[model samples]
Target: MLRNRVRELRARHGYSQTALANRVDVTRQTIGFIEKGEFSPSITLSLKLAKELQISVDELFWLEEDLDE
Candidate 1:
C-alpha cells in the first residue's frame, strides 16, 4: 500500500485541507482523500505536494509491504 505523510506535513506546516488543496490546485476533498489513503496522486501532483510541504517525494510517500505480500 501507499503510505504518505501528507497529514503530518500539512499539520507541521500549519495548513488546513482547503489551504493545501488551493496550493496544490486540487479540491479540499482531494486533499482529504489523499490524507485518508483513499486516493493516490499522480506524479505531478505528488511533486507539487512535496514541494508545498518542503520535502522530497521519498519523504512524503513510500510503499508499505504487507507481511503476506
Candidate 2:
C-alpha cells in the first residue's frame, strides 16, 4: 500500500482540500480520497502535489513496507 503525509503537509501549508485540489487541477474528492488512503495518485499528480506543498515526492509518499526499514 502507498502511504502519504498529504493531510499533514496540506494542513501545515494552510490549504483546504478545495484549495489544494484547485492548485493540483484535481477534484476536492480526489484530494480527500488521497488523504484517506483510498486513492494512489499517478506519478504526475504526485509531482504536482509535492511541488505545490513545497516538498519532495519521497517526503510526501512511501510504500507501506518502507515503514519497516
Candidate 3:
C-alpha cells in the first residue's frame, strides 16, 4: 500500500494540521485524511504538498510493503 510520511514530517516541523493545511493551501480535513491514508491526493496536490513541506515527493510518500499478486 502507499504510505505517506506526513505525520512524521509535520511533527518534525512542529506544525498542527490547521497550520500545515494553511501553509499548503488545503483544508485541515484534507490533511487529516492524508495522514490517515484515507485519501490519495492528485499529482498537482502532491507536488504542492511536497513543495510546502520542503521535501521531495518520494520523501513524502512511498510503498510500505510489496503488493502480492
What TM-score number comes out for model 2? 0.92
RMSD of each: 1.3, 3.0, 2.0
Clashes of each: 0, 0, 0
Off by over 4 Å in 2: 66-69
Ranking by lDDT: 2, 1, 3
lDDT of 2 at 11: 97
TM-score of 1: 0.93
lDDT of 2 by residue, 1-69 (tens): 789999999999999999999999999999999999889999999999999999999999998864556
The Cα error of candidate 3 at residue 18, in Å, is 0.3
- lDDT score of residue 18 within candidate 3: 98
By summed lDDT, the worst window of 10 consecutive residues in model 3 runs over 60-69
The candidate scoring highest on TM-score is 1
Off by over 4 Å in 3: 65-69
- Model 3 / residue 52 / CA error / Å: 1.7
Candidate 1: clashing pairs of residues: none
TM-score of each: 0.93, 0.92, 0.84
